[model samples]
Target: MPRAPRTRRSKYRALSSLALLALAAGAVTACSDNDSASDHSASSSAPSSASPGTGKVAKAKLHMVDNGGHRLAFYVTRGSASTIVLDSGGGEYSSQWKDIAPKLHTATGATVITYDRAGLGKSDVVPGPWKVESAVSDLKAGLGQLGVTKDVTLVSHSQAGEIANCLAKDNPEMLSGAVLVDANLPQFFTDEEIPRLVAATQPEVDAAKKDPEKPENRQLISTAEGFAAAHKAFHEVTWPNSVPATVLVSEKTPFAGSPEDAQRWRDAAASFAQEAPNRTLVTAKGTSHEVPTERPDVVLKAIEDMFAAQH
Candidate 1:
């Protein structure tokens, strides 16, 4: 088949980039190494009730796990019984949950875990497109190494929702429940929607290409490379009814400026929740896509309720 006109192709690409840019709005701003030291201090200083009668904060332990050839960093705060795994959004790493992780640990008395995904934070970058299977494998391997095999409460944000869905479907036995914070729901990736998102994100992808060496750009490139195909397949993903989930949709969604897109986002969340009896949808009032940051109390309460329900 003959290729389309260059102008038309470029137009489509620019649209695709805009969609991805909306999805990854704040991600670029957090692409610095400055969070590393501060994250450590925050985790260490945050009060934890895990230690009975001692009144001392729980120390967070760092573990380097090998995935194929590269290494992924996992941070753990020791607690009892259940384990809560916090996954970050697109173009972000483990430090995205630095504040919430420690607080969750203290509130629930459950072992809280956070980790840097491949090519982000302290994890070794693997050249190539971002793949959800690889992401799921990394998380599973790290959890296995840590002996965290059961009773897991997965707290995922934005892009990590894809990882959480796959984990819940593929390894239902490993997770008891989940809390999705302003996340990307598979319901949003319909045949028509996928093309729109890809087209919208094209401009951002093009800009990232100019500065390929930057950490955020690298992530954007990898993610954009597979966005259309990945989401097309993602549209077919079904969340298992066995694993209960709480879906939190921001009042002003990731595409707040675009009314049509914003309504679609909200509708998708409602659709996902309606699909299963075990799923519950909650709106994060007065917040944007950065729900965890804007309303940590809501995120905390949701996770706490989910954890408590499991027991």
Candidate 2:
């Protein structure tokens, strides 16, 4: 396919940067030595013979797999229970879970996996917009490459929650459960609302672009156009009622907006939970949209709650 014109590409890049910045600040940063961060997994737990689904966290191995031409980096903390796969928010790297994953592993005693999607962290970037379907495919391909094909629990934050939803819908049998943290629910967004949503998040994008040296400027995991595309795609997704899920609603909103805006955020989260047959909503009283970072405890508890509900 022909690439978009340079002028269009620039516009998409600008919007994508804004969308990402608004939804998740500090997501785009210069790539670092993957070993420096993933090394934390080695200290998390030791390898054990516990069988899958036994809730035993063993030492995890770091993996850097080639997803087609792009790299997908992840840390697999081995355990005996259903593996918990952590999916970060839009443009956020797996390191967003750094403060949470180790503690979560220790607490749940289940294998935990956190990874950088196609273009984040140390992974390679792809062409054009980031599609929701493509993101789901990458997760499956990345997991399959690691020899993980079943008994998986998906824990996703923010925008990635949309990807997790599609994963559960398409492969209900593969998932043990799902945990959504302040996830985006396109079902709740109307055509009129999208532009408003985009507009609301534009300031952050503008701020990032205003300063070209900002690391986030280079973080090209998902463009605003990609996010908008995913939002539309999510509307067509049908999450299986058979998949146990836990949706966490942060008390704070993404931007410092009116109380009504915050309420709408909460409502959207609540609506997502209501749609699930086997799901519950847990409101984190003192955190913002950066649930995984600001309130790892809540994220951990929500995952634990989902596991308990399923088992």
Candidate 3:
């Protein structure tokens, strides 16, 4: 095939670099584990409840919940018995799970929830550097106000993994299980690996700095501000042993272009699964870093299995 034009190639390269930067460095926000703010009152426009066996797809109700001063938007498809919360990757909106959330509700008869992070999608953006502690507090407060305080199956992708790890560690009783899809595991943020990731993504961070007014660039800059130190703290985070989890690692990991980094990614997933008896690792065969989009069947099956195990 003929090589693309210079502009096209540059655009593609920039996008690819941004994706990689978001994958590795976006979760590296710092705050004390106890830095989470208290839950704020959530105001819902509609009731988030639907009777199972109504012979119709459950309608998703939009709920805007306050997290300190700004609000996070959460969409809930009501069902009885269990709740499944789908968190998107960094630089991504909750709409990433639009096709899967309703299917999960239909297949498992569980209340399905999806939300935009602080700056993504319709959620109000809080100025300053991003903090995983604040992200955890947003989800916790949203669930609490929605009356989904227990029996939750948290399904997280990419950078959301950091939030999930902290949430599970701090509020173990609230979660019954988790399905992590091609997520950022703590094992990959070791002393040896963090510097390599930072070095690789620094160029994109520099590019983002030039056009910081763009939303994507702003997100990249904010998330990468404390990349090195934050990940050092992230490296110390551990998934709670009590919460059962199924980790889905894509066959073509986020670092597919780099064989060395790809191996480290795979090794991290395997190491995590090996550490806890309750943890399970499943490879999403013939898939890319976008596992949820590339292989929805694998993602759905893993989630359904985790949901079943919770009962």
Candidate 4:
């Protein structure tokens, strides 16, 4: 394949101005979560203020499903060919897939849909100390409730890697393929292996449980909550899903990692290929963590590549 075009620095430069934008947007329009190795501090150029479920994103068609007695909120962006159900990261719900899913739908002629976990977005936050299985159950029950049939594709980002993996492992019949965008690989970094990463997220979690609706407390809660959600999400994820998988990972290692970490990430992607043989691991250069926002076109190509390869 040829080299992917570099995104202009100015595109990412606006990250600095996002916090004020986030606070003003009235809390959220997307969803996010974190892992042990995930970043805690806002980069000088990261968009700290992009709310996951508010403002322009509020118009997203909300859907509900029953999971273990709790009603979960999920959203779908309708398209007309095949359907793609995307899982957003921790601290994030269905709203994070807002722009990118639509793009994928248009480019590939697929219907892209995303939704929130139990308490993450428009859904009610229930009791029982959420676990990774809850997420898996949510996906299963949600799809069943929505009347989504077999032969679907899974598109996920960050912590959502677990959701996609769980589906592929238990119910291989539902999938045509899987797309992992900056995904998690427990074989490389497990729950116990990322304690420091977990510790950094407690503050953010506490802040969200304390006040998810406050604008002044945004900085205090965002990172920690995101990390806590992701840490919980990591336990259920695994490799060897039966269908062909596409792993889209970032080339840059900003911190909490080394050059070898990228190598490890690729090696994990390589492992996915080893299992499926048809799995394609594409590296989106000049990015880490937030590939969909940092460089969507690169992510877009990987989707096209995998879908094409399957045909």
Candidate 5:
């Protein structure tokens, strides 16, 4: 496979600078380490679970999965047709994908599944080591309990990117394709990357240690947790050798880097697509980190593109 349509070296240089600047701003201002900032992370309990609307909704049901007694909450959207699974971002529960799943179902006529992890949303939080293998297995079991088979396409965002990777790696045949939105992919996290992120978050950790629920502490954990959750294994999910997919990155929130940071998410995705049956990385122009909620149209189109290629 040819290297083909990659961004020019100059572009990478520019984006790289941008990345640095962003990181500097984040560092000085304490991007991920800010305890003062509020990052809305949903609680991992049934009492705090989001409700499914009764009026205009297409009648979805709440399904529970028993991962060796660890219960996870999931919404099953029964559209007039097909099946699609929506995966949320870091520190996010399935509740977050509520808006996007319905739109996808209405527009594309597919059943969509969105759920909370073991500790987020309605899922029961556990005290075990949350690794990548564990996360993938939970996802697979949830899908299995719902009877979602190999004919499904996964729509994953942010930290769930790792989960998507795990699924493709574990059960390649169970997926038709995937929709990756602003996910931290391309190797999960290298050794250098994780420590740097953790070190960068020291201020937040320090703040949080003083008060677990303190606002300052919450912000830092929110930042660090997003990065950490991606690598937390659920059920042996790994990246697949060939996944038909689209990667949607934010244009509003610049990749947390300097002016030199090459915002070549498209270039990277194009490179990844080399092995994918079909792939595209598009810009969600003027969108936030909350892409699925902020720009369902962008996600819908991307998924449509993936299915189009699959067909």
Candidate 6:
């Protein structure tokens, strides 16, 4: 309940560097599908093939489950006792866990679940702007259908952290712990700061808008919608104090922003960790924002720590 420490591993200097960093980092193209709000009724039946680039389609470990009438694809690493659910960032499929899932399983012997969100990979494309509520619902429904109703640890990256937060908030008893890898936190960006932050992502937005036909572009659009939704959703929610959590902030790979912006990033991460009853911040070095890909060991260790805390 005491004021959380100002935990940081970097330094900040000026707003000029911040502005330039804002420009260079915030250059993602500005684009959104206005029709994403429309809900399409896709068949909830699971598909036999894995989504493209969702790693090897090992049938024995593959699952297609109905998450509120929409079929979602999941790749599982079967283990006894605990189940670690890997939630990828925006624009990524379950394959993003390719480098870490096996290692996690080997290290902890916990069942690892990684899957594509509604419209990614081999999953059916129903609608756009996958809201945080919908995302969390899908995850919970998938787990329920798989008969995994207990002893779960959520491991989330980037925007997917919103879903993890929602799950942890509403279903503390359902989760053993949570690990956020270079994730977006609740209310981390202020209104005045939002525009500046959006500016930095302009390049990514532009690229997606330029090529509607490209799969990458489509995926980017889907990811963008999820980001937009998170921006609004995180403000309305609160994290529960009961669930144990760890937030891994990447020090080597700073966000594309000024030193000041970087400081904000670190401070936000620290704030997220400080809010919960049992939470810690780990400054991950020698890695970029893609810490799961670059430093799977950090993620694995975090998962291990979370499980240990529960027992």
By lDDT, the best candidate is: 3
What TM-score does candidate 4 reach?
0.66
Taken over the whole model, the C-alpha lDDT of each candidate is: 0.74, 0.63, 0.77, 0.54, 0.55, 0.63
Candidate 5 local lDDT, 1-311, one digit each (tens): 11112332222222222121111111211111111111122222221122234345464567767776677777776653356888876555566665566666655656777887756666776543334445676777777666676767888876667567656765778888888887656532434344444555455445555765533233234334434334232212335656677777777433445222223444444555555545666778877555776777788788877755664
Give the Å error, residue 68, model 6: 3.9
RMSD of each: 9.6, 9.4, 4.9, 11.9, 11.8, 10.4
lDDT (Cα, tens digit) per residue for candidate 4, span 142-205 = 6666566675778877666756665676677878888888776544444443454445334444
**Best model number under TM-score:** 3
Q: Which lDDT tens digits does candidate 1 get at residues 8-87?
A: 33432343233322222223221111111111112233223344345677877777887676778888888887899999
Stretches of candidate 3 exceeding 4 Å from the true structure: 1-52
In angstroms, how far off is 159's CA in candidate 5?
0.3
lDDT of 4: 0.54
TM-score of every prediction relative to native: 0.85, 0.76, 0.87, 0.66, 0.69, 0.76
lDDT of 2 by residue, 169-212 (tens): 77788898888887765554545455666776566456545664
TM-score of 2: 0.76
lDDT of 2: 0.63
TM-score sort, best first? 3, 1, 2, 6, 5, 4
